[model samples]
Target: MNQEPTAQEPILRIDGLSKSFGPVRAVDNVSLDIQRNEFFALLGPSGCGKTTLLRMLAGFETPGSGRILLDGTDIAPLSPEKRPLNLMFQSYALFPHMTIRKNLSYGLEMERLAKTEINHRVDEIMAVTDLTPFAERKPEQLSGGQKQRVALARSLIKRPKVLLLDEPLGALDKKLRERMQLELKRLQHEVGITFIIVTHDQEEALVMADRMAILKDGRLLQCGAPEEIYEHPADRFVANFIGVMNFISGVVTPNGSFEADGLSVPMPGAAAGPATLAIRPESIAVSMNGGGIAGSLVDAAYHGLDRVLHVKIAACETPLQVRVPAHTSADLGIGSPIHLGIDPDRCRLFPD
Candidate 1:
């Protein structure tokens, strides 16, 4: 979980930003604030306008309306080169022919900085990114992770106020990508620069971002710390998008309870109306004999650390998924009688 940034002022603010292309609205009227030193992620599925929003911030794509403020000054009118920001693309776009050191110093060289100063900055960032040993290697000669480090080093060498990453670790293998997620977070903290990353991967955003904004079909759905977004999603879309969620359709009863199928659960403060109850797979406990709700195990998937069981019940149309420790229910097979235990307080109720 991330500490609340309520007391600190935002370093970057997006106010009513929007963009369109012919018949499609790529980015809607979205607004958000990113505090200094925060690892912020723009997360959503493909075609959700996350990249468009990031491009607008980088001055690569102009927004049709709204303002982008950096340090309290509107940066909407500023060109990409004029803004105190840098965008690292998914492809990295490093020169295949250039040495790692040369790639790191390319931006500073283009700025016409002194050779000595450029060398110093390059050396400093190389050490910071752990690319010092690979400085003499070319992109073609380096591993994927090594090349990524070179690209990151190049971006940081300029000392930009904010760094924008577009799927920064997309090209790496699964294991390496997972490793880089933590590295990216560490780098952000060590550099103390605002990092705004655009990614379609939910797990990536959840793992790396201190705070994240969820986008859906060009609209800003919700924004908050990773845990808040996952544990307390605002709506059906958010609940479904952030992680695996089980939704059970029900109606609020007159006596302040929710009734679904044959089961009734306490739901205080809920009005008498149709609602959807959302719960995570991990939150629902399974027992072989008796518990909260009676069900029959339909299938089970054996993951390395956990088992995902699909249990069929009369309460919902689809089988409910329950995740528990691996081999915990190894003795139980398909068609086995089971019971589900749900924590009412952990369940979220949304109007249907």
Candidate 2:
């Protein structure tokens, strides 16, 4: 089970934050509370203001109107260097010519710390990030993951109250990126620092963040734990963005039944009106034949562990995706007639 953040006093608070570039509003009246030692993510697609919000938090971008409070004190007026925070950019900005130790020590040295103290801090952070093995290597000598670790170590050696990561793993290959996702989570827990990462990848956010806020078109859409957001989306945008959802447009009848294109399903507690029902692919079951909704398999994608089938039904315009264990149906093929079993409890109803 994923651990939830406690109700401790929030370490960072964004209040009515908005940013604009001439006629374009990048971040519009966004607000959030991030708890101490929490691994929080700002998630959204491109042009959704996730990166802009992160920049504001990093003191790299000034908000047109708002207050950013760090530990109860507004830090909006502080410069990037003055804020007790560090931002690790997507491009591991380690000096190409500098050794890993030099890269890690450069920031501390810039502050004019004693040589012994800088060395001690660098050594400590390198150990924490497991970069000691490549301490003397240049940036070119290290792998993408190692370079990322070096960048993270450089940002973290200062013991900042908060660390901001802007798509820190986007440069790595698929396998390495996935490995770093878990590694980043483990590092966050080991250090007990508040980490705020901005990423458009839903799976990465879900895997690493303790809590996450979804943004869209410069507005805050939904904020919650991964399971909460995935299972209980607030609206259509969130349902569509977070994962694959099949929406069946229908109207709730007086008998608490939903009626669509020649199909009706019991939908208790739904107000009598037009609404959309959202169901995940995994929540639906498919079989060769049954007393359920009739559909024909349009396509089947054979993944290693599971098979995803696109079933075309007359009730809806688009095909509904059904995921099943790969071992269960070896003969399921395209154009095969099938029946769909939808779990009512797993369906989310929203007013149209």
Candidate 3:
């Protein structure tokens, strides 16, 4: 996580940004500030308008209203080429006939820079992205990872103020995708350029972003650090979207307590009506013998280092997913009596 410190002033700002296509509103009054040299993520599921927002930033799509400010200057009217921004597409989009060097040099060549300067920029970016060794290879001759590096190198050669990526690692396998998450972060740090990536993968944002904005149905839900949003979701949709959440339904009494599932917890400022207590799997304490809410282990799921146990409670309609260490779940089996203890402070209550 070590990298350059982000400046206090925002390098780019979206003010009341909105985009629409006929009857459909793609982005609705979204606003965010992205700091220089920081890795920011725009994350959401399909049709959530994350891609539309990114397109607005990249100048590919014009905003219906609001303004886009890059270093306090409005760039909404600027065309994509005129703006000092670059976008890397998901497909890599390399010319099959071009060598890795030419692919990286194409943008600079178009600018009609001196040959010496162009080669210098290409060489520096190649080394930064580790594409120097494959400089002479054509795009079709390279592996997925190498092609990706070449595409990235091509963009970085321009030394853009901001780089927009649309699911850059979507084509890679899971293992390679995971590895490239850190690699992208490293490149962002080394290049000292602000990177705004649009993706639907929750884990990708959590693993790569310094700060992230989550969207749904063209609405901006929350923006914060990965852990901040994960620990303190804005609402039920965000809690469920960001990660696995166990919601125990209940009603808030005037005394400020939510009672349900044979469990009662404090819910301050909550109105008297139906509510939900959301807790992550790791937050719930599990035990075989303790004065806690009792449930039966109905099913189990095995992950590498963790096991997800599905616990059934009579008061709850569906089974709760509880995460535990692999070792702790080894001796447990289906139909085993289990007890869950959740601290009142660890739960998030959303009043409906």
Question: How do all models score by TM-score?
Answer: 0.95, 0.95, 0.95
lDDT (10s digit) by residue, model 2, range 259-334: 8876677998789999998999999987565768888999989999999989998889999998999998788778
What is the C-alpha lDDT profile of model 3 across 187-219, one tens digit per residue? Answer: 899889999999999999999999999999898
Error of 2 at 302 (Å): 1.2
Off by over 4 Å in 2: 1-7, 287-289
Question: Model 1, range 1-352, lDDT digits (tens) per residue?
Answer: 5875644879999999999998899999999999988899999999999999999999999999999999889999999989999999889999988898889889999899999998888888887888888888889998888888888888888889899999999999999999899989988988889999999899999999999999988999999999999999999999998889999999998888999886788998898899999999999988766867988999999999999999998889899999999978879879988899888989999988
RMSD of each: 3.1, 3.4, 3.4
- The true-versus-predicted C-alpha distance at residue 265 of model 1, in Å, is 1.1
Model 1 RMSD, rounded to 1 decimal: 3.1
C-alpha lDDT (0 to 100) for residue 234 of candidate 3: 99
How many clashes would you count in candidate 1? 0
